[model samples]
Target chain A: MKQRLVSPVRMVWLLGALLIVCILASFTLGHYPVPLGQLLGILGSRLGLPIEVSWTPQMETAVWNIRLPRVLMSVLVGACLAGAGASYQGIFQNPMASPDILGASAGAGFGAALSILIGLSSVGIMVAAFAASLATVALVFTVSRHAKGDRVLGLVLSGIMVSSLFQSATSFIKLVADPNNKLPQITYWLMGSLSGAKWSEIGFILPPMLAGLIPLLLMRWQLNVVTMGDDEARAMGVNAPRIRLWTVLCSTLVTAAAVSVSGMIGWVGLVIPHMTRRLLGADYRCLMPGSMLGGGIFLLVVDNVSRNATTAGIPIGILTAFIGAPFFLWLITGKGDHYEH
Target chain B: MSIEVSHLSFSYGQRQVLHDISFQVRQGEFLSILGPNGVGKSTLFRCVLGLLSGYTGQVLIHGTDARSFSVREAAKHIAYIPQSSRPIFNYSVSNIVLMGRSGSLSTFQTPSKADEERCAWALEKVGIPHLARRCYHRLSGGEQQLVLIARALVQDAPILMLDEPTANLDFGNQLLVLEQAKSLTRDGYTVIQTTHHPEQSYLFSDRILALQNGRILTQGAPSQVLTEQTMAQLYGAAVTVVSLYQDKVRVCVPKHITIQEEAK
Candidate 1:
């Protein structure tokens, strides 16, 4: 008999409810502690509903300007990264694969570091990072094309080599920067914090994220065939190489955009997809959306903790690693067979 | 003819694998390719599938040039089943079978109600309708082979090509898979398979093609092609052919080298 824990429809409904609850709770439970009634009143007033203006302008700014943008960015970036990771895992047919498996993160890091060293504006840095990430994947694809046997294995090996190449370039940029000003900026950016997130930056990320993610959603079912290995997929009349190329391109675009905005947040991409697979089956129709929602909630909760945990906001990259590593260890030790087919 | 190949030759950068191979398969015929390891059986299959290019050959499927057909177009006429291996993901059996319909599906379109009905029919035809909802990876080897056969059956192609269908099966399971292949021929499907077992070819195949040293050594009816002399020449070992049950069953047994030396 098939062992199903929860039907996919029910799982989707449950995740949607949890996401809504998490968003509302995050808006209310920050350091400033806006009351729920006032929060609703503020929203209701903006929507032109008759509600009392019980909150001060400072509370209004904190909710709308400060907290809302960060929270929204958290959800968007989280969904993009996790969705891209799931797509990569399917294309490569490896559960261990993530968004950065093909050096997207490393390439973006190098681009951001170089831009910061040359005194580029904030927007310039992000644009450079996004471009470099795509460039890195293109380079990796070219190298793999020259490799003779086993195309998937070739891509993975070349990805590792290209990643190291970009990482060293990033290190070189960090070495020559001014220590007090430019070095600290570069280091903090690499460490990843959402403290200074703004509506404009969120606007910058949305288009590319959608451009990459929408195709992934549409091709979700096709991903099942691609993951079945190349020969089988070819026998099914799928252009395996072409589908793989499209998947990689879309995944790289979204992952690069997310990393450029958030500055190298880890673990959400790698862990959320596995967690989703364990809850739902490996059907990408369910796995893709499940990972997106799961990643959003995970990052939102983590960002909430980062802001409220102390006076100085902890770097999100550190916190994700702090939480992600232990959780991954537990999953490995307790439920290793869940990953094995 | 369902499939016709003439003077097919292939090489891997100066290392020749298949040399001057020519054969024709008629409608509803079961052709068994018998060869030792590294005798270019798989390479020949790849060439037929249009997976390997730069081969000197003329392969026609239903009087259409195979080389001119795109991969998808070729798939409409011929379906391929690789040897069954454990998949990395535990997808449902129905989902696995539905992938066979991909050749006919338009881009961005999900499987429709008709496609689902076809998948159901395939599972029923294979006599494993109960396994449709079960995880594919949990099935046994024989069951997995049957599932793959059903997957091919769902392709709706007239010609089916299998690579070592019973390569990993045990004795009884091997017979089970072979019987399934044999049954497909009776349904007007042209089935071609590569196998190492000569007795299986004798029992189920309408024709046998023996390959040795990257060349065809013999090609004819099983009775004419699978003689004791040809069997010994193909394997480079002494073998004896025996018949039983009023000469209705044929088997090949290899002579023991140690016993022969002691007697000498």
Candidate 2:
């Protein structure tokens, strides 16, 4: 039989299949190792399939209340991070730029850390976290507006400096918290897990994610122009300065929200966009959605391993660092294809 | 649209570059700025393009002060192709040209079918249509300059400005760029350019504006401004100017013109 390579249509089907596998696999990878049948039964029950099951509270609590929300949160946060990263790298015209490195992430991390230092509880923490994230994004924007026109280098450099400052202060603040009571909690949160994600956290993130992604999708072609450089972009009739302003504002907002809740999910925001570029090419029309799916699924898998990779219950970031390091090294030293034309 | 600069005096940090330089570009004339290096050709062009702020003068493009125009609005009226620039990254040739469309577009809008057609036409007009899909940075220097000119052409602005547009290009590419500039001027688009080659000013320009040490030395026809005396004063060297076929001026510099020899 002659071999037929898959078309883009088939490839899209493959992406959908992979998404299903990831979701199912995520539900089964936790500590208790919920059986495939029981996992499906719980999911089906929630979806109104009326499957009968043992009413053991452990099954209901672990599957419905705990693992389900955590997994969903992982997908949502990962998608947001990856999308934000793609937009950011596009605007900066640099392949290595990520949401965290440019100060947006650090700023959000600092705001949340400061809120924790002020002794807010779980209910208050969510409010403080989202508010602080938005506030940090606003600070980056306000500082970057040096002239009447949009200033790209100005925004990026300031972002870097501000982030470093916040990071040092966060370390100092973390040091002074009560070691026995609050220190361990702060440490765990910094590991960046989906364990804290709730319905309300989802609610807060959804609005900005949708708001941010809509403009990006609409202006996808302009992002193509921006990649050419600002002067060239202006000649194309893009109001290059204002486009820069709007894009930075939206990307910063999404990144701030992602960093606020998860602490700092590293690599997904940077590497996923590059991966999408390699996979789908630099055309932002497809690359934007590709990064969204790729980022979420990558994190979903990492989170699965974090919950049950070892008996020690490893912190998510440690596991992510371990998984991401070898690939990053391979990306740097291997075929030299990351910025392919 | 006419470009009018009147009583324009500009300086850079106490070092004056242009003093009371006044000129008017008729609605579709090809105007050339002719001067040796260190003259105010580029400074004058930048001031007219509104790239610099706080210069005392009046630069009116299409009957409005340059300061009154937004960057995009100015781009719509006056398109610029710099002498050369290094983007240092990979972007498609078509994408590079598409930037000329942004000044007329909104943030939420995209390059339309009409815009893409214009990009194609501009690239084809400059004779580099095949490079549209290739990486911009990998093109040769001549090809890069052509690509930038194509971008400006696509802007479809009424007034086009080029600064040293032929400085680094090879002989053939220089002809190519200059001829394209000439065609734009012929099409009723006011073309303003700066050149070090005095002969080039006569060959390609309808009006020559010569500068020496931050002031207009002379502004008129080639025969009126370019002389053996003017070349000697600008370079401090002995030279000769000759009129060639088709009213083109030919410039020749002696290999061994010394002050001692001249004094003797």
Q: Calculate each model's fnat, 2 decimals.
A: 0.38, 0.41
Q: Clash number for every model?
A: 0, 12
Query: Which CAPRI level is candidate 2?
Result: acceptable
Query: How far out, in Å, is residue B85 in model 1?
Result: 2.5
lDDT of each: 0.87, 0.75
Model 1 regions more than 4 Å off: A44-54, A335-341, B256-264
Model 1 chain B TM at 0.95
* Model 1 TM-score, 2 decimals: 0.95
Candidate 2 per-residue C-alpha lDDT over A153-173 given as tens digits, one digit per residue, 9 for 90 to 100: 777777777777778987987
For all candidates, state DockQ relative to the true structure: 0.46, 0.31
lDDT of 1 by residue, A1-341 (tens): 33556787578678878998898899888678888888888878878998878889999999889888998889888898899989988899898898999999999999999999999999999899888998998999999999989899999999999999999999998999999999999999889877888888888988989999999888887888888887777777888788888899889989988998899999999899888887777888788889999889999999999999977889998999999999888877874334222
Candidate 1 lDDT over B1-264, as tens digits, reads 999999999999999999998999999999999989999999999888878868997888999988998768887888888887566776778888888998888656678889989999999987899888877887788888888888889889899998999988898989888898888899999999999988888889999999998899999998887788899889886777778777556787666754585589
Best by TM-score: 1
* lDDT (10s digit) by residue, model 2, range B57-124: 89999889998987778888888888886653345677678777766677677678898999999999
Query: Any residue pairs clashing in model 1, and if so which?
Result: none
